[model samples]
Target: MLSSLLTKFLLLSCVNHCALAALNGHCPPLGPVLPAPTQPSKHGAVSAAATTLKGIINKTTAAYNSSAVAIGVKSIHESGFVFSYTYTPPDKDEIGTQAVDLDTVFRIGSVSKLFAPLALLKLGISLDEPITKYVPELRALKSQAREDSPVWAVEWDDVTLGSLASHMSGIPSDLITDMAPLGNLSAYGYPAANSSELLSCSGFFGTPSCNRTAFFANFGKRPPAQVPFSAQTVYSNVAFAILSFAVETIAKQPFADYVGKEIWKRTNMARTFATQPNASLAFIPVDDIWWPADLGFEGPGGGYFSTINDLHRLGDAILKHKLLSPVRTRKWMKPVTSTSSTGVLIGQPWEILRAENVTSDGRMIELYTKRGEIISYYSTFALIPDYDLVITILVAGPGTPGEVTGASMDLMMSQVVKTLLPAVEKAGKTEAKAAYAGIYVDQRTNSTITLFLDDKDDDDNDGPGFSISRYVIRGVDVPTTDPGGTTLPASAPPALDPPMRYRLYPASATTMTRTSGSGLEQGLQQRQQISWRAVGTRSRGADEVAARDAQFAWPMYSCVTWATMDRVTFGFGARDHFVFNLEDGGRAMAVEAVGYKVRMERMSPS
Candidate 1:
């Protein structure tokens, strides 16, 4: 069960060369890795979420062998604050705890899986490409978990790069020691050894580190763990190891070196080292005692040490599409699996968990998390995208009962979400969404769009002032024929008709659910519908207010197209979003959409 929790936690993040990549079509070769930047002093601003964490830990530590704990929380979206706290035991030697803040680095364990995919994606490698293209030696691994299976060996090409990243590679969850039944997987599962032995070339791998020659020699002689091309997700550390190996082989450098060049250096994550630089900071955990420690070698599965601020910077970069293109970022977050028994959907190097338990109102919680735990440390890095929030927690302690490594990250998450749910938020809301409507346009693309209130004036509607809004991308000539189908005639451009209009029903005061004709072009009878949640809301305090400014106005933000893969589902690729900056009374000034800003001038009422 603890293993299940561990499998549920690993997640992903960003890289450097982000701006360069956005400008150019490819990620350039990275230069020397630089040090992390100095963070401004702002420790007192820990959000209410931190308060919940402190309360929980303060109460829960009563059951622990030692009361020392370290916590980190950053709420950058709405409230720009970074908070980190470290607790040292009265008898410091007993817990072996260090006085470290959010910037203090610790072993991230499986959270390192998140970085692997980012590194791989930075190389512009297709997730659908077969692993054999990078590591052909994998062909040596066959379909047999044991040596005596009579079936012919399946080619390694059957496994794609995405499968390995998402744990759908069909590789055995772990290496088999003594020919046991798959049902006994819990007993002899992956990384079957402790952290020390996980990446030990002399132990499980039976090959020299980064040496394909040694690896293939050992791999060819053994039976495969599972059949290739199988859809069943079997979380495999070996698969990640192979991915690491392939990335290194392709880059002609070590995995850590490549990541440092591509990610940390680029993002100014100065202290986020590939290895634990200060040995004194690491602790060895047993039942109730934590001594000075050593984890293991850097690998694709888990081998990173990062501070709270650095991790937050990484998440922010990914969210803003600064590290990767919005399209790739969306694809990276898209579900790689259908619903599994655990109600989990695997994404690249991470898992989007659909919690089985429901809130009081039957609201299902979908948690996007990357969790990690080893002998001495446990961490949970999560993105609650719906709330525009990211939570990162790292704690080290004794092997307490029930929770793994004496950490209640899941409970901590649940408590935070429940306390800050929309209901709680609305109870405190003072502003209305009436001031968020206006006509906006993207001048850079010559794309004109309008967001007008649908005054179908229905007094029968429940609450005070919720109204439907229509978003129309006018002058759009959404292509009729599929790109792969019959070619459009040279004169087809002029034949386009009416603009695509979408009706947005109120989901909340500021948010709207898109109900639209599938694709812009209605050529096919089976029109695949598109889904969008639009929010035109704003908040002030970059402090641009003047005494004459009667309205406390801010930029209206919304991401109309959160997913790019939906284009494949909906036939044509035309999704646009905008952040409209308004005049005194929510009248439009200018708006930034997609790549550039568009000036919006209000038209006099006709």
Candidate 2:
């Protein structure tokens, strides 16, 4: 009973010889499949995953400035359950108006980044292989430490495909800014294309033959980018572009042809493509304004037009190990944790969400997610391997991209998962009490943050299995760097906001999320809301997880990290996560909010 959209639907019933069948087989009656709610419900029931999702869409439609969005759900056990819900944009159609549903396609930006790695993996190319082994131009280019810094030379043969995929290679963040001017830039460039304030590229949007050979040639031609190669996890759009070039160079075929045969065709993504096959593409509104730009030039990374059905097909294929081996696919989803202790990690293009006991499977479930934003569209996908569950959200804003306060995508996904598949708690584990409470201060800005576990309110829901405890935050600090090398904290001496309380729900023996709370007050990424997952330890840093029942007398899971936050706008899709540094071994030595680019030392354990 999928909303009105499930009429004559198709699901991959079996996977034999990497082939699929469409059948209406028996699926367990787990949750309610309801129609789109007129309003988004904040407190969602267990049987209302779809209803809750629709509610969220309805509430945030105006807040996020989105014109239209399509959501797809695919679950596999004995049978496959695939269904989708699409919201029609209010105004008229620019290209094909009726209302783009699961069939309508969109250029999923960095989400396309995964295809490059998958193709390489399918081609039997090892992740550890040097990228220069394929593309000779990369080997010939000089290496720079920074775009404006003195040009330094290095052996380009050292950079590997895995590093580039994981965003660990210190490639240029922007090619048009770091490299020479383009010879044949596309004329259909939108203001978002040329504006780094919005996106990374300053040249073309889609695939318009913007000269890949010449682009790679100019890499070492000038000074290097800010971060050097093999440095930390610094995001580089050019690195992905280089990966595309490498894949094409190694296969001895154009990237478009290679992916067409290798990935898309195998997944049965008929209406999908790596390039803009149609010129009269739909009007992709940014904010409320329609944005029109092609993602072709950066095809390997950003330019991919796919439909909801195709995305579900792709997810199903991955679950069935359609292209790569299970071992390879598992490795690709593993976390590449950063050294900052902020819990950030990247394996291939997927952002690893590490949590403890997030499902009933006894084993720790890791949710792999990827988010993409080009000129006109913003897309995201969350996949739970243990549950074989996948949720993909494609959004087109109907208003200004920065000004509006959209729904919290992370929270929405987390809530949907919680409602649909309630996590089994670690036996003997009680509500998380005092380990995280402390007065933490940022060293650079000399500003502080104080955490308090508050008393239960009289009017609060006290009849639950485990009573919810309020986690309060008092002081907030923000730092910014000047044009010079000196760093400056915002001059407004930070005052404590009326204590912001986020209800903490215990996931396992040691993990808690802001899933039950209202999240943060202000001054973080998007600052709209901050949904957090905290994993505490008595040791210095996060320890490796063996298995669920193996008995973690010590550390629980690996990490629950966050992506970097935006300084100017706090869109709040991803988190600006904080990590506790334990030096005394029992309590934290310091707390590092890595995504916000600040570190706070613990004064004393409360």
Candidate 3:
């Protein structure tokens, strides 16, 4: 049986369009969904994989300043189950293990929409089914006596299940503020309660605070008919809740139980659930109690839990069309609404879009992905179809400090994708070389230094073939030269003693030799041989020359010249000297000076 299961899984692992077409009416043979992958009997390998993945999560969390993080991934062909990893920062202890069982229950938040759309699809409910047919309360709410109600109250009479699934129902992102005060009565009150009080006071007939009864009474009192439809992308939890209620009315079963029996169980998602963890199961206590206790039990918008193994199974099942028929599954994944050039379409809770492309060796590859985040927990599930790879990451506890946001997760996922995916596509595409060719002018010296491709007949040919030419203010005919000439006296030798002269010659790609002299070849050789170590010298050498010229006129001093075959520009002034270093390997080599600190800038190819 195990061999047969593995064979079926291996056949289903390929995710091409052809594979999807092949699975048009196919479902995995009906049986109990396989259990979560058993723990490896060899503890060493399991611990090593866990430890490595944990370290990765910890590093990513720290980089994002997140308090905790969890991640899981599965290879459909090789692993056949999800491997999970998690991390929690030092400051938080919210009563839960970082490692959650695949079967463990937690609020899936908006992920619950995944099941709602599936349920509607299974009932042969067209995406265009008018919401009013299932939930007549919306019509009753439209007939409120309150003048504040829109003179022409808008309802979901024309909106379809499709629109709600894709967030185009024109409903507000949240009705919580409008519904909060009504508490249990809100849904039943006036049947059209737009305020908190109505929701709190109304309930089903014959029960204390029976909002459902009041809601139905009010609903029956009002006439029902289709209303005008206005379509726009609007995220609304209320819409999904209403839809879940509609599914229950039609299917004659609780929303959670219906979804579990028909969808999750049939798909063999044994670890999946549509409810909160009961006393029998271990639950990590959440520190913040802001969430309503009832909300956790309601499974439409935000309630479910599963181990990494189950998630991978879910990914595989979706890819293989084991639950919904291929035609319906494709519809669920398709973008129902057109997005503007700048806008993105929301397919169910997943954002439907193309993956980012990396330019390498002039080739492109696509990676389809979906990411999730809620309160303190963050999650990501990426599917690289061509590579047959699925990556999922979940995080718990506080994310980066200040405003709780998904920007940290976005940054981390971007980096991970950039680093991991492209390597599989192509290899050995060298990065472009750094462009270091330029003339840098020192504003203080009014001198220009030209950094040129070095062509000197030096034995160190392995180094970058670049050198710097020190030009006096008068010698070079260049634009954008510094206006102030060198601080050296006008009497200095024009050839080598003019304002500044420093030549840096590359002894090798990594080592540099510099020579400085005043117009004499012998002096050049002597200076070149001098071991000029990087040091801190206070005197500018101008002081010594000035002391020798006791007549009190300006001192005549020789300029310093250095040359490098490596791409670098050298500049020296009374107060400071700078070396602009560059290498051909697209890496930044350091710029060194005698008294000042060195700085480097990594250059990118244009």
Candidate 4:
């Protein structure tokens, strides 16, 4: 039943924009059109943007003296815009100056956690099910309350697979603890470090005792940071380690093999590995101590090594819904819990970020991202679904600290987002012009409307929606006419003195199937039903209008714009609601004014 539900959702696309309109104040009254998945389009602007990005990567990596940095960017809208850049520092040590490419492997650190949830989901494992269902040994565990310590023994029965995946299981951050690292606890009335408190066998700390038995023994001694299902997001590497045990128990095979077969193989990520492959095949940084450390049980948590090409393939597969259904993919990408920062949230394993002001319109873009650092290897993978953009950055070198790597990645990401959005928007406008921006006329009634794309890029200067230069009903200019024969109604925008404007926004989109067509077009032809809102507005000049109306021009300019905008009504429908009659390739053949009950055929551009 669950599988069928997922399948149904996968086949369906978001049909109505009204839900988004109701939920987001930033959204227009009609809401934006539901965008379909697009392959890369041919756009020169994207190429220029890629060049700018390439320069930024080269200059920044050189400045940091990065031993090796591999970056790959793919834009869904532009096929030729795929960019890849790899840098390897000059010859040093026995290995000498080895070249790096998209396929050159590097340890991905905590980024490996991203695959664990995917594997569990593929196995049809109910994420909400208690961890004890798969790993029965956890059923015997109970919490121990301590007055002085923040840690308490985890009631594993209370922890679900989802909680473990999302870092909300309240599991302790790690299983291993060093007695000497505790320092003097006598001041807090706690016992001083003793032999009993010594850090024991566990793979998390690179100890040799790396089997499941040793892991469970060490875990029982450690305590959870909080109760299960806590609202707080307390990251626990051990959570994934525990998840690996559940996976192995259910599959009756090692966790690595399962992920390799199900995810990597399916996604075409041939260069990714469950563990650090031989050093000869990987681009290991010189004198890296963490490179040689065996992860053992922690391998599921932070032990995978992947290449830029592999990460790119993974990102594409996710966005394209190659493995999971579209519904499941979207749900998995969403935030599971909020963090302290309003801009940040935590998903199953994603560090989701709300990036504001990346676009010229000042709208926020959510970035589904993950960051990893193990030893001197740093990596970041992000998916910006709004723009259908994927970014992968991998760094291997001596100076790969969290701060340094973070800043570098931030620079790359910021540049990409800022540059690509405008490029994509411009490309979209160009495409829109060819398809919808033209003169539409009702020759029987001599009515006409001319639509054009706004040239101004600044939202503050002029609101950026599809602009209308002319509108006439029955040869009567509605914008300039008084409330008699030419006027729409009182509910619509009042007749303006001069400079009247109308901006069209997408309201809804639907799909229709042919029931009674014949000949070559007889076999179930599908057409897209699209509704656009004509937001008619009356104006003098901005200064003149503000001077005339004291009440409308407020200290808070258009704060209640949603209340007034797109509310124009006729008898039963919106006065300015227009529906496009699209052909096979989404070209507008004609537009119907819903309230007016009049259809206008599109006229070819002169």
Residue 121 error, candidate 2, Å? 0.8
Q: Can you write out model 3's per-residue Cα lDDT over 1-606, one digit (the tens) per residue?
A: 235555345334422212112112111111111111122212244345445545665565565332445455554445543245554445533444543444443334555566777788788788688888887666666555343233334454766776676767665443222444434564465354345333433112221332234444333222222133344465555556667877888899988888888877876777666644542332233453312233422346554555455566667776556777766766666555555532255676566544423322111233344555456544566664443456665445444364225776666556555544344222111111123334544444344544443234532211212233433343442222322233443453343322232323222112234444556764354211111111111122322322323222321212112221112223432222444444433232333332223232322221
Tens-place lDDT digits, model 1, residues 79-151 = 3544455554432332323455666566676787887788888888898989899887676555322443423
Using TM-score, give the best candidate's number: 4
RMSD of 1: 16.4
Single out the weakest 10-residue window by summed lDDT for candidate 2. 17-26
Order the candidate numbers by TM-score, best to worst: 4, 1, 2, 3
TM-score of 3: 0.51
TM-score of every model versus the real structure: 0.59, 0.55, 0.51, 0.76
Ranking by lDDT: 4, 2, 1, 3
Which ranges of candidate 3 are over 4 A from the true structure? 1-56, 63-66, 80-84, 90-95, 98-105, 145-152, 179-231, 279-286, 290-292, 296-298, 338-343, 359-373, 381-388, 399-405, 424-606
**How large is the C-alpha RMSD of every model relative to the true structure?**
16.4, 22.0, 24.8, 10.2
* Tens-digit lDDT track of model 4 for 1-606: 235454345224322211221112233342232232244335677667778877876676665544677887786444433567888766322342377887888888889998878888878887899988998887454422342243656777788999999999988887543444456878778776777656555444455636677665555666667887777789988789888888888889988888888889988888888765767667766666667666777877887899888888888888878889877887788888988887788999899888545544444468888888775778989897765778888887776443235566667667767766666655556666777878999999888888776545523222444667778877777667524223455765455575455667666424344444788867666655687776554433233222223233222132233565435556776666888878887788888877666789999641
In terms of lDDT, the poorest run of 10 residues in model 4 is 16-25
| Model 3 steric clash total | 42
lDDT of each: 0.48, 0.51, 0.44, 0.68
Best by lDDT: 4
